[model samples]
Target: MISSDAYILGKIKEGDGNAFSLLMEKYYSVLFKYGLHITKDTDLIDDCVQDVFISLWQIRHKADSIQFIRQYLLTALKRRIIRVETQRKKTLDLHDYEFDLQFSIEDILAERQVAEDNASRLRHILDQLTSRQKEVIYLVYYLQLDHAQVAEIMHISRQSVYNLLSETIRKMKDFWENAR
Candidate 1:
């Protein structure tokens, strides 16, 4: 049996509007949040995400080889955002923009006094990481994507994903230990 994602892709390739709607409903917010980490412009993010879906629908028949819809969508969205940002560079100083990953303690922690402190500490450590490291950590742990999926989404080698994840974990561990 085809997995739900594959089934959705198949339906989409067959021009099933409902399947495309389901795909959008499933991934729009995720793409938006990921886009936020890449660029601070909300309008750009919205437009890029919309473009990704529209492009996907247009190329659905050619997307039969896609095994992971989320990874494919994320990769396309990231490329779209980067392309838009590059175009904007003609008018704006690129240095003014930063690809910072915004994390919220409330998103990661339960409502407990002790957990709040731990969450804050973790957030600080996360903020200390390089943008690429933070992106790897977010994709792997927060999004629950495997190294292969992360590698695909980030357009990096699987080995690079492993290295980034391991180094980020090592840094976080050292910070946690030193804090104790």
Candidate 2:
């Protein structure tokens, strides 16, 4: 019996629509889960995963075998998420939101508010990080991709991935401590 990869590959190369449909059904959940981690929006995750498949189908001939398909799809999804985030950032006025607030409340209420505020602050801090650092953090922490995967995607050595991740964590820790 032919493996799913081989079956889909052959059908795709032959331009079989049914095979593509089947492939989509087989991988949609996995892709969507990956997409959600990257994009952080269920609705946008759907669109991003759809775009990945569309690109895959359009460039089927140029693509490598189905064994590499998951990696390819993930790289594409990461790029798309970055593009979307950049566009979204451009339209928003950061000056419109006040990052600093003075408040007096009970310890419990203050802690909850501080936590919420910290989450918002973290996003801004992430934006300030270098692209390489941001990418490393997303791959390692967000998508749960390992060091080898990140090195492969970023075209860097495994040691470089480790270095970047270490620096990123240190910088984030410093930023939070200083901010507080």
Candidate 3:
């Protein structure tokens, strides 16, 4: 039987520790993997995730208000990790903190039987994309999150997510066409 996040959330709001445990079990690996795309420090990511969950547990009363558990956890982790990294650097300038999505779609392209040269060209194009463009593609295509969920996790407007994804697709198409 599939577990419903809403049901789990309801239990969490009622202060059920077991329900909170289930939520942690379900999301720990996913959030850890997502964290790797932002920063390569596994130790730091693990600590940051623990902190996020601890904070959530402390505010369990608001659990019932969460719309999407995955989206909520993802956004929380993203902010926590970024803030921790920023504070560690001791530079008040958050402008330099970029997610720098460390993911690639090359394996999927290979499965599609795209020509080796084409895949190489695509990688080149992907490398040229801005960090936000790359993140939008990863969030939408790899993670399979909808625009609203992606926007929430990314801390951007839903329309901005759509626009970034559109722009990335256009760039890929342009490269593919020119390479043909």
**lDDT top scorer:** 3
Clashing pairs in 1: none
Q: Can you write out model 3's per-residue Cα lDDT over 38-139, one digit (the tens) per residue?
A: 888999999999998999999999998988889899888888778788886776443344566654666777677778887788887777888888777777
Residue 98 C-alpha lDDT in model 1? 51
Best by TM-score: 3
Instruction: Give the TM-score of each candidate.
Output: 0.81, 0.53, 0.84
* Model 2 lDDT, residue 40, Cα: 53
Tell me which of candidates 2 and 3 scores higher on lDDT.
Answer: 3
Q: How much does each candidate deviate from the true structure in C-alpha RMSD?
A: 3.9, 9.4, 2.9
Candidate 2 regions exceeding 4 Å error are: 1-3, 64-67, 88-147, 154-156, 162-180
92-166 per-residue lDDT for model 2 (tens digits): 321122111122333643664557666556656665666567667766875577788877766679999999899
Worst 10 residues of 3 by lDDT: 91-100
lDDT of 3 at 154: 80
Lowest summed lDDT over 10 consecutive residues: which window, candidate 1? 90-99
Give the lDDT of residue 55 in candidate 1.
Answer: 94
